[model samples]
Target: MIPSNILNIFTNTEPSDISYKEECLTCQIMGSATCLVAGAYFMSNLPFLGSNTSVKRNPIWWKNSVKGAGAIIFALGILRGGEGWLWNQEKYLTNESK
Candidate 1:
């Protein structure tokens, strides 16, 4: 689980009248989605693009970049999942009370 401080870096919440500093959740979701999709696409097509040849070594930077991007995307997805779970719980509790 991401620490509250780190999560705060990714999302701001309004408590009473106080607005906390945080990254836009929507932007996080979009960024993660884009990175994951793009990384997957590039990785899948790399072999077919003659990048598999021993003489023409695939760039190490490219591999690392894709992996790193994918990891960020995966982390964001986990955070979003937590958010969604809390959202659903709130909705459920609200409905139950009514």
Candidate 2:
């Protein structure tokens, strides 16, 4: 059986208990890092885009488009990573809880 702790990382909803907060934080950080790396990779021209004849026809336009997409991904990673600190009950609890 998959452990609740492990499962929680993949799920979007937080558990009622705060015990898994650390795991959630770690998951977010890792996800952020992965996104950032992927963004960087996409932004870079290191990967050969020449495989497709169409891409070869307009390399500059394709590179710019890819870079723009990478920038958006990088921004999303930054936002996701920054939310790690807001998981506490005091900050995250709804108004109904107050």
Candidate 3:
């Protein structure tokens, strides 16, 4: 069985009366933060948190791979932003008409 927390992520246990604005805000915040953090790591060599902290120690292919992955992640976050906003809009309209 899937863990409760993991399952909860796939399900919305919130009450029907909850506002869509709140949900959208939560999603946007989470997505933006994730993308920003990951993109920063991929593009920099700040410290231990950065994947290229020891660029000289690692190989060229690995660095390129990390950058590619980061770009994909950032794009996904953009898609998520649109999805989250649209979901909230649809839900809000449906709820209002009910």
Candidate 4:
């Protein structure tokens, strides 16, 4: 079984000090953009950091692993950014309408 401390890192049982709604729009955009850019970079497999001789010798499995990571990051970016932007727009629109 996983230890409480280790599981805590994986699970967000406690509330965050700063709620998502309180986060600034700029921060949210930057966070999402960073994730998306990083994901794309990884997916591209441009040998950004692995241009070394030893890295070049890596097998196909390693490349596949990187791509998988990229896909996850890209999805995370979409979810995080989409939720924030959509929610804010909804809130603003509701307030304006009333």
Candidate 5:
């Protein structure tokens, strides 16, 4: 029989009991930073139909900018909101083995 310790590695892990509050807090801060930088870039660079008369408008620019900004907002929101609910919960975990 395989050693129990080795078998444990293959088995579905029990829900993580450690809250990892510190790590979550760190991620939230980083996510906020990501949002700020991304937001600034998108706002300044992604505008369509600017004042230049020769500039041709591209629809893809707006779509991609909105999509990227929305994704960042969503990820950061999860990180920030998760700190209070996800990590603190007794049953919640990111277990992929199950």
Candidate 6:
């Protein structure tokens, strides 16, 4: 499971006192969503790599492998963005409270 702090970074609602930055929000959401989807799709397929399932024998296996590799890369993006989001949100909130 993703850590709560990290998930919070990707999932927080906009702060009420803050001005909305559409570009930032859109980028964050899109990046995170894309990363999550790609990662999940790839990671899910990874378990099948070693399986004796018919999928292993299919030409699709090669495609799946490629996708799996892409997913890992995307997942890393999610991690990076998630950390940044959390940190920024924390700083914004703390400063606002002062």
Task: Say which candidate scores most in TM-score.
Answer: 4
Best by lDDT: 4
Candidate with more favorable, higher lDDT: 3 or 4:
4
| TM-score, cand. 4 | 0.57
Clashing residue pairs in candidate 5 (N, C-alpha, C atoms within 3 angstroms):
none
lDDT of 1 by residue, 1-98 (tens): 75457677568675554343344557657765765565566545553476656534757777666666666666555555455345546754554555
74, model 3: CA deviation in Å? Answer: 1.3
Estimated TM-score for each candidate: 0.36, 0.55, 0.49, 0.57, 0.35, 0.38
Collision count for each candidate, in order: 0, 0, 0, 0, 0, 0
| Tens digits of lDDT, candidate 2, 26-82 | 788898998899888888875545655676566777778888899889987887787
Q: Who is ahead in TM-score, 4 or 6? A: 4
Q: Model 3 Cα displacement at 14 (Å)?
A: 16
Clash-forming residue pairs, model 2? none
Query: What stretches of model 4 exceed 4 Å from their correct place?
Result: 1-21, 48-56, 85-98
lDDT (10s digit) by residue, model 6, range 1-98: 75557777788887765564333556767787877777776666554556546754646757667677877867676765775456657754654555
> Which candidate model has the greater lDDT, 3 or 5?
3
lDDT of 4 by residue, 1-98 (tens): 75567667889688775633354568878989999998898898684455545655766788789888998999888877986356557765554554
Structure candidate 1, residue pairs in collision: none
Error of 4 at 91 (Å): 9.7
lDDT (C-alpha, whole model) for all candidates? 0.58, 0.71, 0.66, 0.75, 0.58, 0.65
Clash number for model 4? 0
lDDT of 3 by residue, 1-98 (tens): 75567666679678575444344568677887788678767755443355455667776777677887777787767666766355547765665565
**Which runs of model 3 end up more than 4 angstroms from their true locations?**
1-22, 47-56, 84-98
Give every collision pair in model 3.
Answer: none
**Could you give me the TM-score of model 2 versus the true structure?**
0.55
Rank candidates, TM-score, best first: 4, 2, 3, 6, 1, 5
